[model samples]
Target: MNGTEYRDHRLFKGTVTERGIIDYILSLDESLRLNYNAYQTIVFTVTHRKPNLFRSFIHEKQRGLSAKMDQALKTFRQSEIAIVNALSYDYSNGLVEGINNKIKIIKRTAHGYRNFSNFRNRIFIEYKLLETKTAA
Candidate 1:
């Protein structure tokens, strides 16, 4: 599923009365339910734009856990600054990515244009830039 769908999934956004189904799964020995609540909190943080809470959650929960989770938390910690910036800023590369995707599709369908100039012109036309007028 895409990011929005995954974010809205039942496993991530459980009812107020109880935690998600993911929290019910136990490890091999069944001695402990996996501490996947961290993931739930992360979903909450990003969805709600709570960067401070994200920092706090990482600081408080990054210890005495399964090896996999520990590594995941470490990776989160490493990118903590970037994550905060993402949450704090409204900036996004989505428009650029969309343009690039369109260009890629055009290139694939055209089966390789004869020259770079032709390909560049095709991209400009796809974006509705018909022509450039020079100042007299």
Candidate 2:
């Protein structure tokens, strides 16, 4: 599987980073297979602030949150259609969303980290340790 990064400046807070993660998942070679006969279906999940700050403000100033969400949903749906047509497989954002939540929890519990490299290493070590414990 290949993982790349997606970045968008317009998105609130961690949106750019989250999109990067999704891009990474979508880049996996086997992610395109419909039946996943040769590979597994790739799932993309992301967790972001509930009531995205940008959206909240936009809604307050514009039609409403529902309208903003509807527009965003439509755009997302269109993007998914395009991606599915090109890849011949289904893509999911649920997993990515979950992972984002998990990351947030971890960060909060630990009271955050001083450096991104340290954070990355900690995450890697935690996963590796979990894998070892599970395998044992």
TM-scores for every predicted model: 0.71, 0.29
Over 31-55, each residue of candidate 2 has an lDDT whose tens digit, in order, gives 3322232112122211222223323
Query: For model 1, what is the alpha-carbon lDDT of residue 63?
Result: 45
- Residue-level lDDT of model 1, residues 43-100, one tens digit each, is 8999999999999988884544677777888898999999999998999999999998
Q: Name the lDDT value of residue 43 in candidate 2.
A: 24
C-alpha RMSD between model 2 and the true structure: 21.9
Question: What is the lDDT, from 0 to 100, of the residue 85 in candidate 2?
Answer: 44
lDDT of 1 at 117: 93
lDDT assessment of candidate 1: 0.74
